[model samples]
Target: MIHLERVNGDTIWDILKLTVADHQKNFVAGNDVSIIEAYIAITSNGYAFPFGIFEDDTPVGFVMIGYDKDEYWKDAPAIADGNYNLWRLMIDKAHQNKGYGRQAVELALRFIRSKHHFPLTM
Candidate 1:
């Protein structure tokens, strides 16, 4: 029962406390840093969105996905418009290896599909 919820004041405290294991710390940036970057993007006219991964009523992980249209597409032409970058996905150490990551990704893909942002081809 994994679902994503927008990061709001009610969930910010729990989100801020989420973390990875000490050994895997170098693998990804901390959630706090990621959230800050998301906020900056939100305020800077970028398409950054942060979400908290939940299992039932518990917050077990976090994911941020969006694209900076002005900056990201400038350097790379492969990514088409309406495409979103999966910026960050982190599942806390306490609840890892339980298929949550895969479920989260599936949900994200479904979300993108639902947006119908891709340009139709003739």
Candidate 2:
């Protein structure tokens, strides 16, 4: 089963070691870079929340949730206070193509729902 864990010091190294395939390298930024960006965004504006994807306690991927009112939504009044973004989602090259990505997204959406900023219909 796929699960999410806070990306603390213990799991940071494992997440940093994850990478995409050579042919897909240009499509996604390295986890190391993403983590750094997440950290900066988190500390500066309290928006990004980074997590490590785990399967049976083994780190398999990384995902981050970013909430920004101005930067993301162009200041939409309805969602002005809360604009949730699935900022990043990545599975290691070794873990790709195994349905993990879909599961990870499911887990992320579930997590976001639990936070419950506004009503979600349909």
Candidate 3:
């Protein structure tokens, strides 16, 4: 029953507590940082939708999707325009290798399609 839950006051702490493996530390940013960036994007009139990947009541990971009109993307390549980026996706070290990552991505794509009415590319 893996699904995406919108990150909010009630679930922020749990989501922030999730972490990747030590070897992956350099690759994925902490959930706290992701949340902060999402905040910045929203305040800057951009779109950042952060979500907690959960299985039933347990929080397993975090994922975020962003639309490209933000000031941060002004200098980004043309491919960024009118496109949705799978900004962040990370499963806690304990939750890795359980296929949750793949499932979470599928859920994210469905979410994006439902919200934006556009097919996500890449």
Best model number under lDDT: 3
Candidate 1: TM-score?
0.84
Task: By lDDT, rank the candidates, best first.
Answer: 3, 1, 2
Over 4 Å off, model 2: 69-81, 117-122
Residues 1-122 of candidate 1 have per-residue lDDT tens digits of 88998888999889888999999999888888988878776666567778899998899999988763534235545673556888899999999999999999998787766665434211
Superposed Cα deviation of residue 72, candidate 1 (Å): 9.2
lDDT of each: 0.80, 0.79, 0.89
TM-score of every prediction relative to native: 0.84, 0.82, 0.91
Ranking by TM-score: 3, 1, 2
Q: Judged by TM-score relative to the true structure, which candidate is superior, 1 or 2? A: 1
lDDT of 2: 0.79
Q: Per-residue lDDT tens digits of candidate 3, residues 58-119? A: 99999999987777655666776878889899999999999999999999999777774543
Candidate 2 vs. true structure, TM-score = 0.82
